[model samples]
Each structure stands twice: as structure tokens, then as C-alpha cells.
Target: MVTAAIGLEFVKQFLNLNNPPEFVFACCRDPATATDLKEIVKSNSSVIIVELDVTKQESVEKAKSHVASIVGTKGLNLLINNSGLINSQRIGDVTREDMLKCYEVNAIGPLMVAQAFLPLLRQAAGQQSSEPMSCSKAAIINISSGVASITENSSGGMYPSRASKAALNMITSNLSLDLKTDGILCTAINPGWVKTEMGGPNALITTEESVEGIMSVLEKLKGEEDSGRFYHGVKGQTIPW
Candidate 1:
């Protein structure tokens, strides 16, 4: 389950390639409103576009039910809370409404998605796999940001984006502990300054590079001990939370 999935480069690259997961959900706020990914979806039979509005409780509940109906008792292997928003710090760019909006989408949204889809993740734990409860455990990847780090915030600005992502980091830590017994390895990952709609053209890397690096880390996520750590997906290193 890829929450707020369609526009992201990670989702785009993942869908384009024939990867490990047999079926992938291209979750978006509005499927009809998503102008991107049309080309990617047309060729990829495995990609399933799901309507999901993370900010709303009712919508999340409905999405969870719909996913449950499809996966049934077999369960979902991975849940990536990739939905987020950023309000720039540039002059006249930030506002009271935008600040609240940032919190709604970036921080609370991931938590809500996790809460809604937890049952299916537990179902995955019940099934047998090579690692079982080892490195290859069921996972929840939260797309966090480096701007969230207070200690490293030398350039300090964009309080809405920064503070919200910081809150998201905390949520990720809490989830790691909360879901530990269920064998779900929940971790927050910063995809780095990638060249995307949000990252802008001057960003250091591309989405494919970021996703590839992230997948490598995810492919070997050890159980409880590995949870809660902040990772730089592109750099393949741990970031201070």
C-alpha cells in the first residue's frame, strides 16, 4: 500500500520496473486528478491505482476496507507512507493555512495510513517467508525529510516543512516500538535532495537513484533493532533524528 503514491518518483520508478512485489498499489489523493503516471500505468498491469485522501479519517477507513477486500487474509507485505506536502520559506510563500496543511499531510497523514493498514501487515507476519521475522520482515517506510533535523538545521527556515517532518520522525520511532511485537519493521527514510517537483531541478540526485538505494536498505531490514532509525536512502547512511 503506497499512500499518496502516484506523483512520487519512487512510485513512478517502482511501477515502471518489474520489481519484487507482484502487485503494487498506486494510491493518490484523487485518481482522476492525477495527471502524471498515465504512461506508467498504461503499460504496467501490476500497478493498481487506488483513491486515497490521507487527511480524512473516513477516506482512510474506506481505503483500508477496499485494500482488505483485495488482499483478503493473505495480507499486504509493505506499506509506504509516501504522501507529503511542503510549504516553502520564501517570501510570501508561507501562511497560517499552509503551516497547518503541512502538519495535516506530512505528519498526521502517515500515522493515519499506518493505523488504518496495520491489520494487513499483521497478516503478512503470519505467513512464511525466507527470513520470517529476520531482516526481510514486513515493513513500513515513511518518506521523511532532512530539514526535520533540528541539530543540523543550520540553514533554519521553512518551519512548516521542517517541524512537520520532525514530528513525522517521532511518529516513526513510536510506530517502530508500537509495531515491534507484530514483526513490522517501521522506519523513516529521507530520500535526500532528489530532483523532483518538490526537490527542484538543482537537487543532487534523481528519484530512481533514491528509490534504488532505499530498496537496497529495505531488502535487508533486520527486525526490531532496525526499526526507528532515520536513513538517507540515496546516501545509504543513517541520519540523526
Candidate 2:
């Protein structure tokens, strides 16, 4: 719901395309909380909401099946591994379970989604109509964080959040290399400090602004240019590993 409400809204308004791209929102909770999303589906029949627990492989597979049924064999053109969790605990305060939970959602979740959806992404890349202008390339965007960049203890706590994002960046880079031949582009984006529930009240940007910036990055994506790079949202620059 958050992705659809914040991320896709920016994509829809900023892109200004003739038609809105179909969207599938996968969540672990009940879809009823997404009242705004439900309204979007009412207006645009192409939107789908499915139950998905990214931490579990079974849940991911079920969600994939549901999406496949909706979009048919054409498959997904874009996959955004945006689902994540943050546990704010200092090094000594952090527990083993907390660290594991963070890794499950932020690192392993994206990897599972990528592996499960590879065929769909490949299908989208190979899609060609009798008219060449109708085809579109496939892409994957993984939401990473600035914590992944530095090893400093400036933040004090939040070890789980920091480590998971770093792991996510590594996953993104590896996936990009593996999927390059298949014409699937994968890149990690640090969406900057935005005032989401996770970003807290002192965040620098609004969720809308951050999403707009990320969408700008997404729009400029070209097959030859940025596939495996780590993007910094605020400066719109690439971050080196």
C-alpha cells in the first residue's frame, strides 16, 4: 500500500504517459487497510492487490502466481523490491532474532523475489510485436539505503537496518551481473531521507519528493548506462562500493 500510494503515485503523475502502467501491490497484511489502493483499482481495472509475505518463499510464489494470472504470459516489465523493515537497536541492545528478522525482509526477500520473477522479466525482454515500436525492456529497482555506504557509528543504533541495506546492495550488484545477458537491468537506489514512518519526523524530504527523485532516476534508466550502480537519491549521483 505504501509503495502504491507513494511510489506509484509519483510514477503515474511524473511520467505523464498516455496510459498508466498496470500495477500489482503485494502485501503481508489484509488489503482492507489500503483504501486508497482499492479506489485506484476501482478506477483502473488493471491494478491488482495480492497477499505477500516477502520473508517467506511460499508467500512470494503465491503472489507471483496471482500476478501472472492477471497480466497473463506477458509477465512483469518492472520489479521494485521495495518491501523492507527497520529495527532501531544499539549494538548491545540488538538481539539475534532482531538481526535475523531484518535480514529476512531486507536481503533474502529481494533475492527470492528476483529469482522467482526471473522468467517473467526474461519474457518481457524477449517480447516483440510485429511492430517493433511496441516492445519495452524489463528493469528491476531495489531500494537500498545510505547506511550501506559507510561503516561509521554515527547513527549509534539501528545495526539491523544498516547491515541489511548493505547486504541488499551486494545482492543488487550480483543480480545485475547474473541477469545482464537476459536483458534485465538491476540497480540499487537509496531513496534519501524522507518522512515516511521509517524516516521519522526529522527527515529532510517528503515521501512524495523522494519518490519523485527516484522516479526521475528510473526514467533515465538505459540498458547501456546504469545497470549495477548504486544511486544516491538526493544528489542524483552513483555511489561506489
Candidate 3:
């Protein structure tokens, strides 16, 4: 599932693939206001607009039910927790509310969504014939950031964003272990410094570049060996988490 901006680009890229998925659920906080996403999928029947608010448990559960009704026994192949929040507050300026809100959106949201939709993912895994774990069968990919890496924290800022994302990385690792027996792969990926609204125009790469590299890395992920690792979106290399 996804939101607008970078998430919208991912939806577009998936549709453009040579052999696209049977269904592309373009999830957002408010589907009515998601004009861009609507426009992109206007002519396509495969893309379904799902109203989802990552920060709200009710919204997440509702979206899960909606998706379950559609996919039915076939199940969902992949779950992408691409929703995120970034606060500009630094160490001295950040408040409890700031940290809580950031944690709610960036870390807890994905965890709730994963918990709700895990049945479908496990169903998909059981149905697929592939012996090795793969995205085509079942996977949970959390969109993380390099700033979450304690070893790579040379610039020390974005206190809320960093801490919450670090929590998300830990969540990803825990899921990887917990879901391994179920034949599900879980990984945290840093989509580089993409030129999105959050990444800013001064960022090193474009959304297309980031998404492209992300797709490449995901395509190569296989079995237990590749799961529970943090990856660099553009470079397709493991990040220091």
C-alpha cells in the first residue's frame, strides 16, 4: 500500500512493468483528494483506490478488510509500508508531541497495518509453489531511511525522524524473524535522498531514480538470506543499521 508523492510514482512504475500485478491498491489518507492517483489509474482497471490512514487503526483495519474482500482466497503478494512523516524539529527544538506524532506515523502505523494484513500475506505464501521466499509469493517492505542507522549518524539532526525510523528498522528486523517460518520476507529499504517533498529539491536523486533502484533491489530479494536487512535504494547495497 502507499500514499501520494513517491508512493504514487511506485504505483505508476508497477503499472508500467512488462507483466504487472493483477491488482495495484493505491492507498492514501483521502482518496477523494487523491486526484493525481485517480488520474494515473483512470484508464486502468487493475488499479484500485483504497482509502487508508496509516496513523489510524480503524482506517488500517478497514482498508485491510476491503483488500481482503477483493483478493479473496488468492491473497495479497506484497505489502509496502511506504507511508512516512518527517518533522523539521531538531534536538533542542523537538517536543514530546512531535516525537509521538512522528513515531505514530512512521513506525507504529506500518506495524498496525502489517498485523492487520498478515493473514492475507500468509495465505499468499501458502498458495504459491515457490520454495524460496520472494516478493511474488509474500513480503513486507518497510520504507525506512539511512538516518535510522546509528553508525551512519554523522550529521545529528531530525531527532523525531531519526528515532522513529530507527524504531521502524527494529520492527522490520523483528518481523523478518517472526515471519520467516511462514515463508515471508521482510526488509527495510532506504530510498536514498530522493527529490520528493520530504527529500527536498536539493536531494541527490529523483523519485524515478529512487524507485527504479528500489525495484531492482526488491526483484533480487530471495529467501531467508535477503530478509531482515536494511538496503540503500539507489545503490542496492546493505545499509549500516
Best by TM-score: 3
Of candidate 3, the 10-residue stretch with the lowest lDDT total is 1-10
Q: What residue runs in model 1 are displaced by over 4 Å at the alpha carbon?
A: 3-8, 12-19, 90-95, 129-136
Worst 10 residues of 1 by lDDT: 128-137
Evaluate model 2: give its TM-score: 0.87
State the C-alpha lDDT per candidate. 0.78, 0.73, 0.93
* Candidate topping lDDT: 3
- What would the per-residue lDDT of candidate 1 be over residues 1-241, giving only the tens digit for each residue? 6643323565666555554456677788777867665566787776777888989999899888888888798788888888878776744667788789999999998899899889888888768454444423477888898898777888767879998999999999998888777888888888788787777889888777878888777766775667889988877788887
TM-scores of all predicted structures: 0.89, 0.87, 0.98
Ranking by TM-score: 3, 1, 2
Worst 10 residues of 2 by lDDT: 128-137
Residue-level lDDT tens digits of model 3 in 57-150:
9999999999999999999999999988888788889999999999999999999999999999999999975579999999999999988999
lDDT per residue for candidate 2 within 141-223, as digits (tens), equals 88888877764336567889988888999999898888777777889998888787777889898877787788777777776
Off by over 4 Å in 2: 1-16, 22-28, 128-136, 151-156
Candidate 3 residue-wise lDDT at 89: 86
- Backbone clash count for every predicted candidate, in the order shown: 0, 0, 0
* Ranking of candidates on lDDT, top first: 3, 1, 2
